[model samples]
Target chain A: MAAATRPPNRPPTREIDEQTDIGEVYMRSLLRAQLRRGLTVLAVVALFLAALPLLFTVEPRLASVRILTVPLPWLLLGVTIYPLLLAASWWLVRAAERTERDFAELVERN
Target chain B: MVSTDTAAWPAVLSVILVAVATLGVGAVGLRLSRTTSDFYVASRMIGPRWNASAICGEYLSAASFLGVAGLVLTFGVDILWYPVGYTAGYLVLLALVAAPLRRSGAYTLPDFAEIRLASRTVRRLASMLVVGIGWLYLLPQFQGAGLALRTVTGAPRWVGALVVGVVVMLNVVAGGMRSVTFVQAFQFWLKLTAIAVPVLILAVAWQSDGAPDPSRPQPPTVREATTVRVPDTVRLRVDEAVPVTMRGTLDGVRVDGPVVLETGRRVVEGGSEVTLPAGSVVPHVESVRAADGATWSQPLAGAGGRDHPTYRLYSLLLALFFGTMGLPHVLVRFYTNPDGRAARRTTLVVIGLLGAFYVFTPFYGAMGRIYAPDLLLTGRTDAVVLLLPSRMLPEPWATGVSMLLVAGAFAAFLSTSSGLTVSVAGVLSQDLLRGRLRSTVRGFRLGAVLAVAVPIVLSFATLRTSLADTVGLAFAVAASTFCPLLVLGIWWRGLTKAGAVAGLVVGGSLASGAVLWTIVFGARFTDAATSVGSSPGLLGALLAQPAAWTVPTAFAVMVGVSLLTRRSVPKSVGRTMVRLHTPERLVLDRGPSRREP
Candidate 1:
């Protein structure tokens, strides 16, 4: 199917064309809002992950865990999964959209 | 909790269900797998929801099923990094490789290797490595299935392993990627429902059952050892433990522990439990108890504090954290989506699914603290989830539930193993026999056998490292190899074939060496450095991960060499990069002509 393009509710493209250095001006203005929102989400996720240990009941009494009577903290830590995923997913979405938008703009202008 | 009369029929039945479903799915997918594109990339048309479901099924393998909960049970709270890494790995994939790699007009890693650098030699080397890594990753999946079944139904270990291998091989050979996608999507729902239903039931049961009797207690924790709460049936270790009575809490859940510990070491876990020795006195454990003044509604184990803090553990963790972006199975999922935007959405869904599932893993691990505390002594924490079903639910129903879980878990392992295998095989067939094989059938045949044999051999040999560690190591190596490849391949205009080779060789060698070292060290001793180093494979990859270091390192080396010999640069380099990132509608000659609607 032809790509979907429902532009945001704002002044039409014909109005923006009137400005001097309008093409670079308009494109930068277009990308600015999205970049800011994406960065905000990123910062929030990072803060949340940093704060997780405080909320948990992991007031560590001992450090060593046993595997066949072997110390297991090394093994156990590898599987700490939930937070990292949330961060990665958040990061991936932002990057994908950014890359796509940047490339599409470059192509349209040329 | 084992009622002695384990007829093995339940376990066998579960395997049969998985096999039937796999066969059915593969057969159906085969009808769609008529063309080369369909067999390789599902015609590059899978939508977000369907692909997301399939990715979930394929991603949540033995590691997520048995290993995650087991780690939580053994190590306390520190192990949450794994599921997070696994899910986030996709994020890395989306950002680094997804759109461009899909745009590369190639089907497999080896195919990418040859196209980017135009080197037959590099393709062969990558093909060999892909098989090696694919097999290394597959062994744990097979071993996990065997472990799951053995714990759940007392079936012989090999039965579980052999059955999954056969099932996966059939699925792959019959339908290839097209078939696997359907099977995996279904498996994801099955596996999700399998775990989700039990967790809900257990939560309700735990709330209504009231706190474990507050009198007698078991080992590891101080508690009333008089009462027990098993969400599933597994062997309890209280019969032979020098019960350590103490109080504990997991994620703020107050678990009054008169825990029957065989020893003081209860954290940094590789999943251990107290098992009854034959000569020892207590045959069957009666019940465990809760403590007085335990305020929390549900009591859980306390997380362990800093063990011998190591720079190495941090590095290993860094490798896993950043390295997930490099995993092939995960990267393949991103390609399965329609575009970069869809890839991002799917990643969000995956994070939700993965995180919610992780929240409940600790509960299963904590339940093991009471009912089948003996699992520790067996040195197989990975089997804890498979065993939990029977211990929590009542007879026939418990067995049936456990049987279903083992099947689902097995499907998880089989699907992931085959998926990786298919990717590697695609690389091998294209690189080694691109022109020589002469037919797609020949390529598929060679790839299929290579996929099955390597992992089966590794599984049979009993690699010393744990399943989670091996997988982490794989992530690390993947990060090292592909992390640089994707970042440099997409962003930099100056990247040369020489640089790509250097980054891949240096990063891959270091990561592979770490795997070898960890395997060797794991067999002899559990010394602190050696214990963590046993899986330095990923850490080595981490040193190379952002490829910021390795890519530049590679770029510098390539430029110096390329400057020294400028004639070797390929004419197609500019065109290739342009094709890789350009929008589909803009291109005059649309790529991947083999794809059909």
Candidate 2:
């Protein structure tokens, strides 16, 4: 690994072909935007938790908070939200990385 | 204790096929284990998809397969919280810990300790605690194997324990993390397929039979109490009651083994359990209306009545809810991926695999609801999934399902025990013998032996608690110790060396002592007076679940200590912070060799 007179940060910015790779650029930008707002990500999560009970299955008897009724909404929050969290985390990171690197490069090139 | 109704050949053949396939994966991994990184951390080269599968294999252990199903069957709706919390653990893991830990570039918890605290003593204590908890958790996997093998094949219980122990040792010794990675990855799919196939078959069978008689409404439950000549002075409470079939009666009474019990009590020894007509009343039996508007199928003792203690519920949830973040096997998975993002992605994948798997647990319990509801009576509710295949299908069809479950159970046991063994060995090697021994190879061997010894002993020693309960104990300990470390370490900049040392020592010791107290001597003081205020007192006792208070206290102590000694903070803090927040590709070498602040 030879040293390349390294800058402060590097984003994967080499253009393969301007006409062909425009889609890639836009997709990366969208991913990058989502990852940048960590506070918003957490806020939406808090909101989702507050709102999910309204979305419980229509069986009122089963939806009852009583022990016998098999509470469904808690199960959805407890079991199902995990994968979504993971996916959100991933999207946030790749997006966060792109943004951080770009900002660092902007500073370095200045 | 009874012969399986299904043919044994398919179960045997599939178990053999899985074993062979797993061994083949290990052998392939062996060929790839040429370097230090490959030996210890799979060279940090694995991608998200493959690593995610391996994480699932290791993560969904005996606790998931047998414990959750049994818990739901015995406790009804409230117990689904176990799986709920177990999976939610990853949500906590992702939200706080995963990315930064990976970015920290440490190999094990001890490594993390050494780097963060810059204290060798702190690192050593953390390593011992990791080994202690890993071995404690592995016991249940071994015990589950024994239970599974005996249940499935009528093989001796020791045979299953020995089988898992040997397989895990061989895999770890042969290729360290590399072999286990491949083996665990394959087992995840095999395990998923194992449970998924049976669940689908059973669901289709139920559909064919018109959906479990949901319209029948629960029958009027009955409990029969004849003065059975008491056998011994010690009374036994079945943790939860299920219908039982008995053969003999005491005091010259005509012994009818198949009668139902309306018993809402926590423990029942042995009795008859059959659904009777709702309106009909037998002369000898006492009728009890289902409590709390829930009916049975045998009424789950806890949810079906207002009778159960809330303290037990709090204890159980405490053990599971915070316990997840502390596990050795789960934490090790985070390190296998190439970067924090990968760790986060893999965790997400695990959530899908685990969530989909958990959705089927209630179905297994519900099957016990229909076909083999007898298991609940036998007080072997944990065996619901195992006994399920036999109860639902006709003799031959049921046999195939039973074998599928047995194979899946063994996979659960082997994958988890092996993963736990690897982490334990890594910690043991890196800390205990790391500096003492000049050669890494020698340290690996010692760690391997140390890892297998304690768990095998504990697996044999534990007799009172169900394997699931013991596993819960382990989770509680983990929640207390490591969960605090990871969560606080990632988010807080002010956590100091003295604080981490204090937390791991204070937190780890208390949690472990609580577990040991319950298992070893607590039952002896029985009125059974383990937690009844005689010794540790119920609440004041070393509650096995530590995170309820310890996690927060640990975090507070660390911060408080750091602030008090603000001038003593490490010079590397700025660099470490930078490294953690920086993207992986920005760094020149992927090695967490020198962290950037």
Candidate 3:
């Protein structure tokens, strides 16, 4: 019975075993990090977008305001929103990859 | 309007050029693709940039290419939400679904259903929904192509639909997803250039013309003696008396002489011609509420003029935001990435690419409002994108630019149709043709034919709805059904097979039923119908944009049913959860290894 239950000579080849307890920890942390980053970005962007309708409603004059000869709503929705989304996504992608890399490092060290 | 004699050759040539380009690119990719994996998911070796380009290519259908500018031109600032919501959807996808879905290692949404629930019943339900949503989505592409061709060349509407149908079928059956990716990626750049260069030239022309604001009290007028032809009987609402040369039939009276169009509406018969004097105010279609410069330029103050404006705005926002993730073609593209991380990166790049492309559309729309305002009278505002360049520029340049735009428009149709065909075919071949077709390729080929055929038949039977409106309905259906499934399937652990099926059936039926009603009887529920009662018609408004309620109901049913069937949860839920959330670096003998041992 002792011989039958003897430990394997080789160490676990893969850094993370998803079925095991430690693997679950690694997965949960990575997911938490990702979720946190995603939520942060989502909240900021959503608030910004949601506020546009409110601003137009509350101060109807805001729509007509011309900044550099362009209508306010046109500038906001048409020109600026695209770049803002691109910037936010770029930052989110960088942060997500960083979190994954750190998790990979932690697993490798273990 | 430019005569068909002059316009037909260039437009036809552009269409042929686009078809050849697409076929050539697809053929090249077919030669490169030698295995089943390549046909389905491009062997999971696509880089982030190329994948993102391909996604944008497929995602920017006729709606993005033509309908957006047209909507913006007609409705002003409120319509900008279409482009905004469209781009922002990827952000939501990136944040929530991107990585996890790729990590799930499912080739299709149905595959994801099977993998997560370990139930064939859920898979079958998903397969039906996928095919349904795909058919609904494909209907608009074919219709838009028909409209574009008929508007450009005097070809019968069916000719355009048939051409696109044949080209897309050939590409899809020949190479499947592998060919589609390259074709779509190339089309994206081509579409970008087509719109961008003309926009630049038109902007310069507009600046030269003193950048006249279209929102002035004076309505749009013809610059030249233009003879307008009505293909179908239409009601023209005149705000003031206007003298015009009438031919064929007007208000059922046949007269080939000058007549006065007084205030209020008059019917123009099919195959009739009316010539308006230069500087005469363009007559407005009864369906589109005529807006002056001030109202046209203002936000939410135009055609859908201020009644339940908030509800309409939020409903549309909800549909576009959530609906994108549920699009079968979009989801299938995620399966092409090697791992979850690559998928996330691809989504990030996609947001950037899509954002860049969206900026050009609104510019064209604003320009079209100024340059091609006659479309308002025709109620074919969707043609504004194609017409603006020719209207503004000089002869040869106009023809050249028009050709470019037409080619880009065709590319939009081909790329999107091909993508839709591959996805629908993937589901059809897998689910319906199982055990019958000896080879997967043969099944897929047959599936492609079925996918394109249904939409082609529907396109002929239906009246041409506004391109964006038709596409929006498809989005509503997708949002109501698959959005709930994906969000719950990824995030929730207790999602049972019974709950999924119930949610799918309930949500899918309600939204699609609303869509069918809208498509069939929508023309009768115009603005005039709302004036019959003091109170707004709640049913018509609800049916018009059903996503706000339908999506929530789906989520509620899914969650509630899931709770009731807790005991029915698959035992492998724990393992599935770990596999989904974990990074690709994590290795466990959950099943067959992706890499060879």
- A1-110 per-residue lDDT for model 1 (tens digits): 23447643333232233322443354344334334444455455445544443333364322233454322332333334355556656665765566556656543553
List candidate 1 stretches off by more than 4 Å: A1-110, B1-7, B211-313, B338-341, B433-438, B526-574, B588-597
Question: Model 3: per-residue lDDT, tens digit, B1-597?
Answer: 442223689999999999999999999999989788888888888898899999999999999999888877767778888889998888888888898899888889999898888889888988998999899889889988998998888788888999999999999999888989999999999988987888888888889999877655666776666677777667878887889988878788997999998889888887887788777888877766666766766666644232565677778888988899999999999999888888988998888888878888888777866666666666777888887767788889888999999999999999999999999999999988888989988988999999999999999974547788888888899899888888888877889888899899999999999887877776654322111111236676688788989999999999999999999998777667667776677555454324310
Interface RMSD of the predictions, in order shown?
A: 9.0, 9.6, 2.5
TM-scores, chain A, per candidate = 0.39, 0.49, 0.80
Query: Among these predicted structures, which one has the highest lDDT?
Result: 3
TM-scores across all candidates?
A: 0.74, 0.79, 0.94
lDDT of 1 at B212: 46
Provide per-model DockQ scores: 0.16, 0.11, 0.47
Ranking by lDDT: 3, 2, 1
- Cα deviation of B199, candidate 2, in Å: 1.1
TM-score order, best first, reads: 3, 2, 1
**What is the C-alpha local distance difference test score of each model?**
0.57, 0.62, 0.82
| lDDT (Cα, tens digit) per residue for candidate 2, span B319-424 | 5655676787787777778887778777677776777777777667655544543333333456668877765677677777777787788788889988888889
**Candidate 3: CAPRI quality band:** acceptable
lDDT tens per residue, model 1, B1-597 = 242224577877887887898789879988888777677678768887778787777777777777767655544444555565565555445444556676666566666667777787666656766766676678788778666676656666677777777777777777878887898888878787777777777666555656342111333331222222222222222333454323333123343544444422222122222223222223221111111112111112322212321233334444554565566566666666666456557767766666665555556765655444444433355666776665556677677767767677777877787787677666666565567777886687577777777777667665544567667667666666766666665554456676667667876776676566656654343322112232224453333222224334443554465455556666655556555654454432323342321
Better of 1 and 3 by DockQ: 3
Worst 10 residues of 3 chain A by lDDT: A9-18
- By descending DockQ, how would the candidates be arranged? 3, 1, 2
